[model samples]
Target: MRVIEVEHFEAWRAAARELLRDGVPAGDVDFCSPSTQKSLFGDESDDGGRALAAREAAARQRRGGVTVPPDFLKRARMVACHRDEHRWNLLYRVLWRLTTAEPNLLHVAFDDDVRRFDLMAKSVGRDAHKAQAFVRFRRIETEDGEQFVAWHRPDHRILRLVGPFFSRRFKSMRWTILTPDESASWDGAALTYGPGAPASAAPSADDLDEMWRSYYRSIFNPARIKLAMMRREMPVRYWAALPETQIIPEILAEAPARVAAMLKYGASGTRAVSAAEFLPEARDLESLARAAAGCRGCELCERATQTVFGRGPSTARLVLVGEQPGDQEDRHGEPFIGPAGEVLNHALVTAGLARDEVYLTNAVKHFHWEPRGKQRLHKKPPSRAISACRPWLEAEMTAVAPRVLVCLGVTAAQAVLGRDTRALKTRGVPFASEWCERTIITWHPAASLRARTDEERRRIARELAEHLRVAACA
Candidate 1:
């Protein structure tokens, strides 16, 4: 066997290329580390000299360079970072197959060699990502200046891959990240790499470590705790380096009592008087809208982009009231301009009424939503939030004083005519309200937009148009 030993990935690649160029079959070669035991069958005393001579000869006889897929190089680089001693041999075997048996060997998804390389690459990539996320720098006072340092342990040789991330993130500060396999230091102007250091060299605690622990404790919502998911994202092995992990047990121990308290009081248990102070004294629509912008009547206002008040003429003959502002309405600072708004517009045209002739507003002025990944999904406002915002809606009604009051959904119906109106049962029937000459109830345009089938959507749209047509003629 032609015994070839290499120290690193680049050296292995150089030696493999020479062997491939000389048409040496993989079975005839013994790929190994430089310090590994020699092959028992044959011992070549001048193996290193013969290998160098072969490489020089192959370089002279190079007609054209060997070629592989572009993605293969990237995959090879990631796999090369793995600490496995057999990686060189595995990669060389794959390279041989790519050149001879199958030109598109990497494309074979189930191929044993391809799967093994993929797993190694994936492991290295995951380790790099976790290292970037979990590394916590602690401030240390030194005679030179205050410097930040962190100690981390990664599963792969990924210091070179993840070093640039820290450099870019802390470009203005001096910091050092030391791992068992490698170490990196940044001095604000330049980054330098050095040999690996022991974990004992890192600081065990910092002055602000307690503050960080407190912040973590404050943000840890016991009600939303998912131990399995937490462990999956932040493995227990990394707990030693993370300062927050020290208090995790304490938090977990108290979680049951905290959760009981939360359940008893509800999420928004704080009771404050209605935000009457934020209301405008002016009886005009524009002034009311401006004042509503600053109102903090309920917790909903804290999260919504802005308060969306009523819009249209102060003397409109018809006034329409719906639930609350949706995601798009919150962003645009206007009511009724989302998918539900589109449905309303189409229904208005079909009912022979122009949208501009009617005043459009929501019973609650602020949007209430919860985040789902990148989206802000609408959540129904609680009864207290609706009650808190009632004064603003009542103010708009009193200012506009439309001939016909159209309640577009259950919340609006309950807000105007009291909860006993039973919006679903009273829809399409005209009634008299003390606030208006005629009051009509109908399904909110959002209800039609959420229909599970096309037929159901059309039916709901027709029902909405009929109710609007009656209110317009009233």
Candidate 2:
């Protein structure tokens, strides 16, 4: 058997292609990689590799190249990252079958080769996910600038696949992630890789360690402690290099006493969850938007198509808060872009405010609607939903910190003010509020759309514009 040595997916591709060109049978070749370094048999001579390349070159001149499905190439890359000794052999078998015998071999799920490689690929995928979740970066002080270092041991060679994930997330900050197999560094503009490193290469602690542990302690719910389930999801093998895991044992130990104290002090047996709990520790607007996309704060999120998050400049001096997303806004995943939005856009122009200059958001991010035949009719959000989603609005308000906050209608007013707040009664007037320097209540453009008469609609629309004028100049 000819010994074929490859260290990565590209090397495997090159060797496999040459072997296939030379009509070498899959079972006749010894597939080897760094993961399979200690072989039962000795290594082959350099002449063997040279002879195989020459044979492949001669065969290429005699016949055209073979073809396989795009799906095979995609799966082969993931399988190559797996540490299975037989991974290379299984991949070649699948490729050979796809090119020589059954082109649709992958579609046959029960085929032993197909199922085996699929399982290997899935394991690699899970390893990549764990690498993303468990890799905790620690701050490292350098004379140059801010830097962070994290160490993790993934079950597979997944640095290539997960490097972009980290770079996209912490792009603004300079950081390095070290693993037993490889290392990656991001300098804000580009990502580069180097040799592997030991766990000791990563820093043990940073200034933020205690602060992070305190935050974790504060958020830990004794009533919701599920040690087995948590361990299963975040396996113990990944506990090292994760500073938060250092405190997990103590937290778990204190669970019973904490639960007992909570019950004795009139605390509910179940913890009260809100959007606040769903918010990411990061305070950036983009991070907040990504976290909101998966929000399960209330039942409304279940029915809504998606979370229609706020949009605009972060430095805006004015903030416009509405009720909830409309049907169009829900489908599009933006704050305002539907018919009612058009009216509001016109009113903004008439009031000397640019749509992109001020922050546009809502009390409820989801669209609360009921099916009416083929169309979905907008429904007013219940008080509970408004309460459940207020945390998101509060987060946005805090992030924006607007000089003036304009409540589009009663729902927005109640969300910012109190549940009993009346919009029409308090329209066109600004009041001191904790969230903003001045809070103004106004009739929503949607209210004007639902008016009984054209004259009355025009009256409300003009009144709405007048209130917006006051907000713009405030």
Per-model C-alpha RMSD: 17.4, 13.4
Give each model a TM-score.
0.51, 0.57
Residue 286 shift from truth in candidate 2, angstroms = 9.0
- Per-candidate local distance difference test: 0.82, 0.82
lDDT of model 1 at position 53: 60
* Ten-residue region with minimum lDDT total, candidate 2: 35-44
Clashes in model 2: which pairs?
none
lDDT of 1: 0.82
Please, what are the lDDT tens digits per residue for candidate 1 over residues 50-121?
776677666657835678887877888777778897888888888889888798888888999999999998
